[model samples]
Target: MFDADWPHRLHSAEQVRALDAQIIAAGTPGFALMQRAAAACWRALRKQFGEVGALTVLAGSGNNAGDGYLIALLAQQAGWQVQLYWLSEPAGLRGDAQLAVQAAQAAGVAMQAFDQQAEANGVLVDALLGTGLSGEVRAPYRAAIEWLNQQTNPCLAVDIPSGLCADSGAVLGAAVQADITVTFIGLKLGLFTGAGPEYVGTLVFADLQAGETAQTAPSVAQVLTSDTVPRLPPRSAACHKGQLGHVLIVGGDLGMGGAVLLAAEAALRLGAGMVSVATRAEHVAPLLARLPEVMVKAMRSAADLQPLLARASVVVLGPGLGQSAWGISLASAVAASDVAQVWDADALNLLAAGTLRAPQAPWLITPHPGEAARLLAISSAAVQAGRPQALARLCGRYPATVLLKGVGSLLAEQGSAVSCCVHGHPAMAGPGLGDVLSGAVAALWAQGLSALEALQLAVWLHARAGEQLGAQGRGLAASDLIAVMRRLLEEHAPCRT
Candidate 1:
């Protein structure tokens, strides 16, 4: 079996740099490390693009350039024609960059300046920029990045693609589009989030002994992949519904009943012992028609909502919830309840508007970037620009576990480290996806997983299901996750027959 723990550990560029220093201080030469990085890139390049005859390196002025130069040297020595374009002046290069240029020269690797006349082709190498980019990409570099992007050749980014922020995954003005990106040291958190996935092709990691030997600093978040998918203990034959937990889904105002139905169905499918829906009176019959197992109730006043809230082991207060009177009435009631709950959709919007109070119970909030921005009172762009800081602020303000939904969905609670789910599919960017997620989370929470544990597993389950269904192609309806969720739950937590 593969190690479940290692791949989930992601580190920031700063932490990775610190690991490099630790490795160097332990008596390994920095140049040797650079050589190892080049060799790893070479191996990955050959694996990805077999028997290429010609290669082009877009070299910059950092250690990233060093990796590119040595890659050019390796290609040149392998009897392949290699061309190097200096995105920065080759003469003024210093440190490892200069050593790389000198070694390439010794190896008869030719280098020249990038210009309008430059034409990059035949398996390109993007070493134009590396980690630690703080501002938008400047012009000359931007032009080179633009040129590199136009090339049709299969490209390899040495460590990370140039112009891709190693921290936030934001594409700085412009970035390289690679066929594959071979990263070193630690798998960057940025690569799984933001624009990282677009710019970073098939991500290949080379820890260069850092996985075990290099002393890595504590990470900011944990990545969720298949190996890290947690499972519940097997159930006994004597197990009953009461041993499991009941979940209440409170949303689906008149026109939005379908969303609440989806959530309720997801909860039931994911093993919630019993599922109830406290929604618009008009939605009850349809809810029952769609999901016969769900006990549907009409929720008009707080009196109607509180009884459902009182009985449910977990409450999911969102999904098809609008910002109107009926939505507000039930949401406000749920806000006041102390049941472990999930606040999503209109619940989040109303909570940000201060109409619905923050929950006093062990609760979780599922907010997309726009909702997160509203909750933090910041711009959505700002939220994307600095997601980690935004997540920290959300955790600080709400006193509830915050699940910020996006490319790399993040989950965090007070006093615990954040976890990122990199398993979601782009097809899930539909209207009702959040509702389904809220229901799955509520079911897990009701089933006795702590907010963190439930979130870690639930988010993975929801995303992995989306990925599976999404493979069927676009127009992936939210209901597509239903059967996949049941199959996954059974696979992970089956009854001992």
Candidate 2:
């Protein structure tokens, strides 16, 4: 339910600063922008702590501290008890920040030096640092952040949570975990990904009338929400079964047949006109019994798979595809198939191991962090540290469009801006979600959307479904997303009923 025109554009810290410079060059003074930012923070603080008795302002000597001072002045005007703790001397402040401190003093707002044992109760306002942070927290700031985290009071963060990297969402040595974060101007990419979500509780954004025109280059990523949901329009009444594409699922060797079955069922449920499965001989019977609509096959070798592969418009490769001889042979064959493909799970493993060549057709790869880490020859921790860089390296290294799945799932093609989806639920972190996601993307591609479009639509569909189903609580299995996804696609991007 995100607004279409809301600034979905996610800026890096450097980019936001550039945008601010542009705004200043375009007639508005730098101090005017600072005033607007402070007002926005002040207003949000008032709304959030309407009934709170006391307020504590944690201030630094940057523009961020300027915001805390303004909030303090606002609280004092309303007759609320306020304690302003400046980590650095406000007398040494420069630029607009110095002006803010002077204004607060003129208004009779007394700023105090930082004291660790002070009675720091009430609504805490964190303006210790801003998006300028890129490395670990140092010295007195680190101690202050540690002390603030130990407090049980409701806290509001100005701009972003202090000490969180504005570009990668990595924490410095420490970060202030606030109950609310009021971000201004451009939305920093860090605020939505990595450790950002954990630190930034309930986020509020204000454009401060920066206007639609960009003073600098546009950002490289945008959040995919209701406004950016890639989907086909409602189908015409004249549409027939033949109009939708056929999807074939390959993999599920030996005892792991359930993996391919989940993929096929997902494709069928998501509106593929026809679905087929190519797996071990023993899997045919159980698959037919479980999902009779899916045409099942006993593919012992590549020869057995080609007929099914030739008939398919889209191929879903690699769920439960083990590393045995049988799996390797089938994976090699599928990787050479002419139809468009969606590679997931073991397929990515095989690709990373160099046992298989990249797919012949335009393809999409869905990899969780471990798989991505393996593909990039880096640790999973490194992948989580800088998702954007990992995604860029992946797209550059492989020919396929990529979806790096995690807290904030990122989808990108070789030449496009990375599209991020933040609508997923925490419960969606369970097993089989990736398998279902691969199937949905293949189904959408077979139905005629481009590879990137299919990925964008499928990822959001899968995640949004998880959000809805997850509301029922933590037992959200991967299969839980299918029905919800089908219903959502029909409601949002309906095929002819």
Clashes of each: 0, 2
Q: Rate the local accuracy (lDDT) of all candidates.
A: 0.84, 0.86
Q: Give candidate 1's TM-score.
A: 0.96
Residue 221 CA displacement from its true place in model 2, Å: 1.1
lDDT of 1: 0.84
Off by over 4 Å in 1: 1-6, 214-216
For model 1, the run of ten residues with the poorest summed lDDT: 1-10
Clashing pairs in 2: 136-173, 137-173
Output the TM-score of candidate 2.
0.96
- The list of candidate 2 runs beyond 4 A from truth reads 1-5, 214-217, 236-238
Tens-digit lDDT track of model 2 for 309-417:
8788999889988998888988888888788889999889988999888976888899999999999999998998898899999999999899998877888989988
Deviation in Å, model 2, residue 170 alpha carbon: 1.6
